[model samples]
Target chain A: MADTEKKKVIKPIKNFSMEEYISSGHRACQGCAEVLAVRHVLKAIGPDMIMAMATGCMEIISSPYPLTSWNIPWIHVAFENAAAVASGVESGLKALRRKGRIPNKDVTIVAMGGDGGTTDIGFQALSGMIERGHKVIYVCVDNEAYMNTGIQRSSSTPIGATTTTSPTGKLEPEGKSTWKKDMVAIAAAHGIPYTATACPTFFTDLQKKIQKAKEVNGPSYIHILSVCPTGWRVPPNKAIEYGQLAVDTGVFPLYEVENGAWKLNRKPKELKPVSDYFKGQGRYRHLDERFTQQIQDKVTERWNKLVELCSEKPEK
Target chain B: MTKPMEQISWQEIEAGGVITEPGNASCYHTGTWRSQKPKYDENACIRCWRCYVMCPDAVISPDLEKNIFVWNYDYCKGCGICAYECPAKAIVMEED
Candidate 1:
């Protein structure tokens, strides 16, 4: 019975690689979850991958002229063409293999970008890649703003968050007027073979999803919610804590869509209030009770909609 | 061995400024950024690897021989994520 019980209990993280793909000493901020997410993703994919990264936080931090943190083949592409470049690389690799120039082995092609690059700047290229059925994994390391350029607001920035461009004022107490763009939903709508929402706090889940995405033959999209301590106005130590709170509060539910089928990876029995999530973050400090309630209601409504969608057969 | 960033000239840089070396940023020390640093207490540690996974800078490594994790201060920015996430309270933050 003791042996059986021991076998039943499974650890969340186990047998992880000690090899660092995106090695230490890069210039990411203290407790930056975006870099951590990329690190874990690279570890999951191993060295057999080619990364086409857009101009964003990860690009800026990892590659600064004479040095790079990446241990794999990586290319720095323009802001709006990471996906396009990834597709091209995938095609090039295929041709190279066909011509016997390179060995016949799968080299997973990945395109990485920040929230601004994904939801705003590179949306067209991403859509085109997905539409053309390229076998590339597009990972959006979203800290929810243009953090590389001094924390300006992006489409992925949530409502009531005060960014540099969307500052709180006497006229507008709530920072951003618009809702955060649903990029995962948009990717799922494209009918990609795989699309998932991941967080660095859940490393095992994130790694599992990445491995799953690699196995799929068509396009895959993974939207990773990277907690930005500098921009979020939280203590650097509270980065992972905020990531946990975001999931517990249902502000950012973790889920995946595979071949038009929706699956919720994490489902809280009762979501903690949105105010609990906003209390420490500096970005949401200006939000009053009225705005807080509005956000809470919106979160609950969306959470319920997501649950319903996950339970039923999604329209193909 | 690569020269310091300032010492290297533009002509020495590869065509298109490609960095042939992988993970060469390990040369740059980021430990100077830390205002507070983490001190590990071996007796109280559980060896759960929470600190290993949570480290943003990837400075923590497992010392299997000693059955404990080690921190490489060369790149640790000292965000205290490991200290904060430690359930056993094995890691404490101290003034740098």
Candidate 2:
């Protein structure tokens, strides 16, 4: 036994709670990083909380006709009203505490939505929630399209990515003509206390942001880039690797905004070319050299702007 | 195990369609969907916990007492993420 123990070397691991808020047996696709992000987020939030989830892939996969994978209090609302429902839930909890019906304790309220539910349908409600200064954490799990609805394109879909609605046909070489919506910028525009972008490939960073969001007094928003193997047409095993590539390529720079101050999480010495990231996925398979160059130019421009923002100190 | 979907009746439905039991979906085994399964080599494992942390199905659990990881194949959809992410290459995806 001693010799066997010596043979196996275990590396030191960061402290992560083993308690699972999202259980197994979920019907999510084999390599669904969206659910993985949810698991890590919930773990960071701990058990004392309520989740208001919009109708999307996560909602459908976790809950079927008569069963659910959620271990904590979770409510499913309409696609456009997850933020609205979350604010309502927060108010109700406050009311109960004031009335002494429930013990006065901090119960974190979190609202979750997909790219389509958040950037398109639920944009107004999200804006209202942030503007109202509700003590809620709104998370947008972006898989780049309306994945639950047969891979339809949404405003959050990246340029040159093919979706059911944004097809690369004889007339249109590029799939989506427009760039992906900058959701973190929109959330920061509301002057929320905290806003950050995270990916499941960096679990520790994702959890750290969630912890920060939970501790903040006012509204906070976290936009997570969930790599979808099914929609993106990548092998299941490559989901996490693709997420890492996304960050390395500077296509999605992981950064945070706190009280109008910007801070970048991971800054690579030199960004990998956009082609290195795009070539692995089937969505960008039809991209010609010109389109890839266009994407590279846009990504570099955005990354430079983010670097500039992070370097500047917030004016008092 | 949960009752089959065909056998469940309207009378058994919970109020407001709320599932009374949390995490009751565990009864529905998803292992059937997997065409391949992971074979773990305990001796080769370094126990870095990478596979445990990245498993989407929550089927990988670290046995703290033994200081090793265990896989619950019942619910593992066998996406091969664990095998692919393993730094030591201790896990291999094999035909189910």
Candidate 3:
């Protein structure tokens, strides 16, 4: 009980304002993690920002025809052009400020998309945006699969998870046979000022990362691990729990690379077994014990490598 | 969820999804989707506030004056993550 009391004292819950930019009543699921992530992200970035959202869950659910959930200036383009559109918007604003058409260029530009749009279809646009040095924040809500498009497998999809494109049936028992694409590393590789991985389970951390990304001068990337109950075959109520398990298990460690310096934000004292994270999700139900062991080994290996990277001196 | 499209004038709609008026989506009540509602028991609560951090809907607002957590039922879909994550065993999910 004393330990529990200490825990309560350590994490004093701050009363964040009830005021929301992403208003209630769009078409997200009962426990949609991505929508929740977006809600917090908007809260962090505040109302003085404009957004370019890709054609995915966030766009479809938030802005459907006449009814819209956004309280900010939000633009929706094709799935692959969110970054490009954001770049154009940033340039347009700059041009407007230069010509004295606008009083000031104070609004922050944000490009948001699902993992499928960010890692697969929109990779080229994202690379171009980073390389060209646009003052914008790109948010990748990684729910592991293309959940909006009926749970199709994407490059960000983790290995051993069953999806529509990577079905585990009579022939294929392991589901998706490939590892998740490390988008944060790729973003860091572009010599960006900021790149971080965040999760909805840790709301404060996620909010802080978004705020930091907003403050950075050049292109910044925030890769958020959003849980999908519908696609992952977990109870809708288990969305936040699964996200916590992901972090605690070291499967998706929360960290940031600020100017090529790696930092591990939350390192669990004892990493939870990867099987504990997988057993609840139906996507990994078909996985045999041996396959689960393999996944465990892989997770441990990745975690060790990340720890080593964090320890080394950052390259100049 | 269906609104009369014909009733809306062309000038009323923005060209893109740019919401000129802020917080207009608050008008649409989405709490009707909840099956199980979370009931907070203050007596059993230790004020750990884990529920405040875990709630996806941001429906839990802390009332420092009252020393209790307030649930905004209008927006809360009652996913019960708050109840499940409550270390104090204070919040319980009840039939809506």
Give me the candidate number with maximum lDDT: 2
lDDT of model 3 at position B54: 64
Q: How accurate locally is residue A107 in candidate 2, as Cα lDDT from 0 to 100?
A: 93
Tens-place lDDT digits, model 2, residues A112-180: 999999999999999999999999999999999999879999999999999999999988889989988
In candidate 3, what are the lDDT values of residues B57-85, reduced to their tens digit?
66777787667788999878887778877
Model 1 clash pairs? none
Model 2 bad stretches (over 4 Å): A1-13, B1-4
Q: Model 2, B29-90: lDDT tens per residue?
A: 89889999999998789878899899999999877667678889889999999999999999
- Residue A94 in model 1: lDDT: 89
Which segments of model 3 are wrong by more than 4 Å? A1-18, B1-20, B47-49, B62-67
Ranking by lDDT: 2, 1, 3
lDDT for each residue of candidate 1 in B20-52, tens digit (9 for 90 to 100): 988887778899898999999986786678899
Q: Provide the overall lDDT of each model, using Cα atoms, as 2-decimal numbers.
A: 0.91, 0.93, 0.86
Clashes of each: 0, 0, 0
Model 3 lDDT tens row, A1-316: 7885544332344634456777776768877888889988988888789899999988887765676777788888999999999999999999999999998848999999999899999999999999999999999999999898799999999999999999998777899998999999999999999999999889889998988998899999999999988899999878988999999999999999998899999999999998999987999999899999999999999999999999889766
What's the distance in Å from true for residue A269, model 1? 0.9
Looking at model 3, the pairs that clash are none
